[model samples]
Target: MNTSEYGKVAAHTLKLRVEGMDCGACALKIESALKRLPGVSDINVNFGTEMLALNHDAGRTSRQVIEDKIRNLGYTPRPAAAEIAIPIDTGRQEDRPWWQTRKSRLVLITAALLAVAFGVAWVAPSLSFYAYVAAALVGLVPIARRALAGAMSGTPFSIETLMSVAAAGAITIGAAEEAAVVIFLFAVGELLENVAAGRARAGIKALIGLVPRVAQIEQDGEIRQVPVEQLRVGDVAVVRPGDRVPSDGEIIEGLSELDEAPVTGESVPLSKTVGALVYAGSINGNGTLRISITKTAADNTIARIIHLVENAQASKAPTARFIDNFAAYYTPASMAAAVLIIVVPPLIFGADWETWIYRGLATLLIACPCALVISTPAAIASGLAAGARRVLLVKGGAALETLGKITAVAFDKTGTLTVGKPEVTDVAAIEGDEDDMLAKAAAVEQGSSHPLGLAIIAAARSRGLAIPQTFGGASAVPGKAVVARLRDGFVSVGSPRHASELNLLPDTLSDQVQKLEGEGKTVVIVATKDLALGLLALRDEPRPDAAAGIRDLKALGLQTIMLTGDNRRTGQAIANVLGLDVRAELLPDAKLDAIAQLKAHGPVAMVGDGINDAPALAASSVGIAMGGGTDVALETADAALLSNRVGGVAELVVLARATLSNIRQNIVIALGLKAIFLMTTLLGISSLWMAILADTGATVLVTANALRLLRVRPTTAASPGESA
Candidate 1:
């Protein structure tokens, strides 16, 4: 029967905060157990974050039942929507060293007992056997109980089972001292592993501390403190010099420099002016400002970032999935191999039963496969956490892996490659009175949501042109045109192609349009009924970092192309500035086709920021979204660059490659060490103590290797620990 079978109804997914997941195999075991339950469709367990993202039919399964199921498997589980409870013994332990942790203290007591037993064995030969027996009983009791618990839970092939069997086998052979030492070291290793996982998780949570609980908002003329969660949109916050901004808002008064390092990873401060955006965690410098909140505290950028990062941690990577699948089979194979070692050697070669059986016990302990199972997930979690700190967010490990290998990149012109804000440069009156044309056009665009329409209305207002107080709502379609009813006739403002199709274009204006388009200006034709009134040419400046960003990407060997709906001349003019290939006059579907065509060459990345481009982003091998853009783009893309600096593409690629390399290194180190230890144990060259120590050592080594990713920094960004 297929284990992947799901409920008939679509499953709702949620991330659950899980505890007592000791290893990658523990994650695999939990996944297997949950899948056997009714209504569960999928389960993604991230050992690094100790989280499980699962999907189940709500009617069949509930959160409380899911929690109960996890508890049944000898683990802890709760909805991730609530804060994870720390299992640390708080208060007294909080003031003491980490070594004083309850688990660590227990391990220390076990070690001290083992030490006294060994000392007595050397000093008093008569009491040596009794001391060793006491030590073995004390140490083996807890291990045996855990093994029994695992057996009762239907997980008989667990690490605890292997440890319990090995210790019992050693003691039965009169190796009581060796058995006691193995337990001491094994318990110590368990404590170290839990601590290591905690440290790995902390890297992702480091940003949580930056969010302020209270904000100072001025409700009349007097400033008062209010909880951030209580702050409402349109509420004004009065930020003094050297304070963190408490909400996603727009500066309505004053000016200052903002250190955006908390969000954008830019070390240098950015100047804040009236109308500029201020995020919840950004630090203000050297000025007082009044900011009108645009988003409440819960919906702010910082909060969204934290949410996405946690989602990323819960998301599994291809390598992790493969490793988990491999471990599932590897564990059983190892048990079979150990069984063969115990019986086959004594029967076939007439070897002594005691020696071969002892060898088999050591082999079982060495073949646990915990290190190999965790190799990829640990590195992937660290990668996701590090990317968040650098202000880049990858949707999952799969995207991170794909991002590193992107060979070709397609960019949307208006927003991605250039500042999407276009200023009105020329309004050529081809027919009718200029004032009437401007007035009618602005009045028609008064209720528009398009950038070009907004620009037209703003230009008209700046020139003191009369904008009608009441206007009909404008209707629009992507890549086509927008139209609204005017008092005189219908006013149309959109693509020149739309104007020509409507028979409102004049042949004489061809040369004028050609000249403006050649200068890289976006020309929008304004028409009414049967005649063209005027054409507005707007110039959207390329972003300051666009050229350098293009250069960086090119130098890194990614082919860059400008994919836009703009006509050929305008597209070419802009592409020429960035020295990129150009694809122009494309509709939304055409952009999707372009992505497919690009993917034929190799893995392609589509960078876009509009609803029209969502299909293209979803179709590409990897999609990169500008954080400031449409929600659809953000949702569709694989990764998000949260700042306008397109140079971040370089940073993202570098970080992805580094993370992949780190994962590879961890896998090699994990498997290579395991193989050598397993072989030694099978050949009777390794003892039970050596096998347990080697297995524990490999776990610590791989964990330490994966932790190196948290130190990964962008090449051109900032030095380690520097605010970038």
Candidate 2:
């Protein structure tokens, strides 16, 4: 989250939970005020998350000085909890009911005074003026105080300033009743805005609630309850049926079905066995599990996810930055227009002074920019929360916006397009029995770690063959073969080229090797110094969903290409089945070059799952790593798919497009309403209270619309060739 580094000087970052920021304008006010202080180099305030993060020189400034400055701006600040820990209590008053909040109490008091004024007006007409004045004063006091604080904090044209000026102007024009009504309506509007903002922040709270308070640790062969924070790596924990897993760990005892819906949004309960990895917050179904903790409480999967989402707000979208810049000048421009309307009509056009002043007050209320400033961040926060729920870990708004603009997708072939594990598909014998050839090959590959070697041994075991026990002196030849001493002669199990170099491959056996290689299978020759034994053909097939997932990407009008280090014939065979283009036999640097060329046409996204693929993943516009891949891939990629499904690529694109559309809708609603009310107020058809209603209604509507992104479901393209 640090924007830059200071040479030879240590800098510190301060994070605070800023309360009472009802709209984006309030966040801007805090940021503008803090920027004037010495040692404050960078500041980021997210209105949707109500989190203020800044970097400063620790030698020049302290946390108390910065917090005091925020208090002077008329907002409360509390120290934020650690980014990777579950947020239990952060000294926030958000848990209180609406009626107990400061704004709600003030609104209730103002409403009571207004009701008393109405009753007094019916009893004595002469005393009605004083009664209305009392009601207006009660509501105007808080508004005037906040307006003064904002003005001193470097924001003179805030919404509170406009509201105070309009209410005071109404009272000066002898419309005390209308002035009281306007003040009361504005208070109600502020209360409603507070409530709506809470709903938008509910997603973060839900994630924090997923972790349980207590964990059952197995110490000295007995189970005892302990706080989750006390859990550490290498500790063993017991998870009973119907209970949530306390932390991220690996199962070592019992098998169970785990419901991962709350954590990963996966609908079906996954069946897990011994040695399987389980995440925190997954529910154990119908069986107890003893798991060895792999990650501590702070480093668990759920904790990391929360940390990612909270930091995502620091990376703003281009559109949101544009709106922030535009709003800086917008408020002053509106204030100037109101002054012109009040002065020009009465001074030059011979209009009545009282009526023109009244219309000017209404225009001031109509020009408040609350709705316009909040349109972008709200939608972006909701979109990010939605993506997190589905386990599509997009880093920030910049990445999410860029994902919507991708024109093509490039996939790594080995583990991305096909199952990474190879299986023995066929075995042929030329000079000996097939069983004897497989047994010799398995003997040489007994403890080998290669995929093809393991597959050959597994085939021998499946057929119940008896491998020779006298084989010894086994060793591997890098990228060629495995050689071993079998009884009296030496035997080698390797690629056909290795066998040919030793003059052990015959023409008839060579033909079989070419035939199997042509069919997208790898052929390993089993031979001796005298003659060739046979060959074992192993293949890593495409995943069951690979074809359908590729079709979906194509349907969305994105070009799909496969990049792999496999042979040309093998890569092309898989590409043909999935209906995509292929670039085979690519090394790490070659993959990087291919990504650069693809970027020339448009933005490209690369999907890969190995350490060698790191260069190409970083070279592309957006790098997406599979969940089961190496840690290097996950760390280098901009985004990740936790479900390990190929179809998630299309889902990510669809979600990005949907979020962009939602943002556009919010902007239209915010601006269109203001345009309509501005025209009516100038024509003397709208009153002061009506203008306030329009502004308040627009802010509430825009926020509610943005929260709709939380309910968005995964969608596919409607038809083939549809533009994304």
RMSD of 2: 3.8
Q: Each model's C-alpha lDDT?
A: 0.78, 0.83
How would you encode candidate 2's per-residue C-alpha lDDT over 321-362 as one tens digit per residue? 898888888889988999999999989999999988998888
**Any runs in candidate 2 off by more than 4 Å, and if so which?**
1-13, 55-62, 261-274, 427-440, 458-470, 473-480, 483-492, 497-512, 526-535, 628-634, 718-724
- Clashing pairs counted in every model: 1, 0
Query: Model 1 off-target regions past 4 Å?
Result: 1-16, 20-22, 33-45, 52-97, 100-102, 218-222, 273-275, 423-538, 629-634, 716-724
TM-score of 2: 0.90
Instruction: After the best TM-score superposition of candidate 1, give how far the Cα of residue 621 lies from its true spot, in angstroms.
Output: 1.5
Residue 459 in candidate 2, Cα distance off native in Å: 4.9
| lDDT string, candidate 1, 1-724, tens digits | 1223563546677677676575776776677667776888767777666678877877788767778777766566755543311212224322245586655766987888888998998999888867877887887776677667556655677777888888888888777777887888888877777777777877555776666778899877889999788899899998889889887899999989999888876788989899998887899999999999998876777777776776787677888878877876887798899899999988999999899888888888887777887788788878888888878888988999888788988899988888879878888887877777777778777878777778888899899987754345777756877777866667877788888888877887666887888888878888877888888888887888888888878877889998999888889988988889999999988888888888998999888774456778889998888855224434668888877578878778877877888888987888788788888877778888888976787888888888788887775533222211
